[model samples]
Target: MDFSLLKEAMESNSFEKIADICDQLMLQVSAQGIKFEEDWPYTIHLLGHLYVNDVNSARFLWKTIPSVVKEKQPEVVAVWKIGQQLWMRNYSGVHEAIRGFDWSPQTQGLITAFSELYTNKMFHLLLSAYSTITVGDTALFLGMSEENATNYALQRGWTIDSVSGMLTVKKQPIVTEQKLDPSKLQRLTEYVFHLEH
Candidate 1:
């Protein structure tokens, strides 16, 4: 199947459409055989799983990634690494993997989306671990400026102790998403190509 469909679906920014397409591609991969050849469809499907914070589904896809694919697209492996770190609540590791991510020039857009998704998820994971953290510390851990961190904390209703610079994590849920334009689909495809051997 042509990636044009996945491209269009991803550009839609609707997780439902992306996931539906991913499921369709997964079925195709099963029928067509996941093999020694390039399987961009399968890879894109895994990306959709990540986009939706579906780590379990993404892990299932990881089991199918050929070793050849692993060697070529370390980003695929990086995806796993990022997920593992998240699972372990190893924000530091997630931070290292995501920040040091040498994204292929072609994937800048798709990577941007993935980066945002992972970053947001990681921040919440950190909150789950710590009930109270210093504002500066939270900012550093979140990779945001102190001011931005304070603003985010305020927005999230996280308690702030101005005198102590402490930001307390309140049990509130929120998602902050700023989607990119759909025009980057081609670049996302080109990026997957770069990951190819």
Candidate 2:
């Protein structure tokens, strides 16, 4: 199977679309009766899924990979470690897995993007979930060093209780406004009237 499409996508840093591209290519590989372990970059394909925050897909991909490939390709195993951490919601382990591996150029971009996405997501979640969190816990959740995480929180307008080593979260107020579409409501009313008859 020619991997030009996959290689081109990676070279262009199209991380958002790589997961879909990998799925398409896998379908072609299956139709052509090509061996998945032959020359395919399973590592990148797996990481692409994670980049899109599709941990379920990434887990399924890990299960489908051949044992030989899993054992021989340490990088593939390392990527799966990140997936496992994500699956278990072990935020600190996710950071450890990411930092422990030396990803190749083909996968580094995707990994970096995933890291940023995960960090931003956790940051928002923590904001809503906590009024105050310890700097150490924040570091684990944000995948940064304690000092860096403290600075990051501070820069985001969060205050720190120096005596307690706790960083206070600055949550933005949520404003929700619901506006119903008249045409849709009219159609629903008509449908109800028709059903009544």
Score candidate 2 by lDDT.
0.89
Leading candidate by lDDT: 2
List residue ranges in candidate 2 displaced over 4 A.
175-197
lDDT of 1 by residue, 54-77 (tens): 778778778877778888877777
- Which candidate ranks first by TM-score, i.e. highest? 2
How big is the positional error of residue 188 in model 1, measured in Å on the Cα after superposition? 60
Q: What overall lDDT goes with each candidate model?
A: 0.70, 0.89
Each prediction's RMSD to truth: 18.2, 5.1
| Alpha carbon lDDT at 159, candidate 2 | 99
Give the TM-scores of the predictions, in the order they appear: 0.65, 0.85
How does candidate 1 fare on TM-score? 0.65
Q: What does candidate 2's lDDT look like per residue over 34-150, in tens digits?
A: 776846788888889998889999899898898999888999999999999999999989989999999887678888888888899889989999999999999989989999999
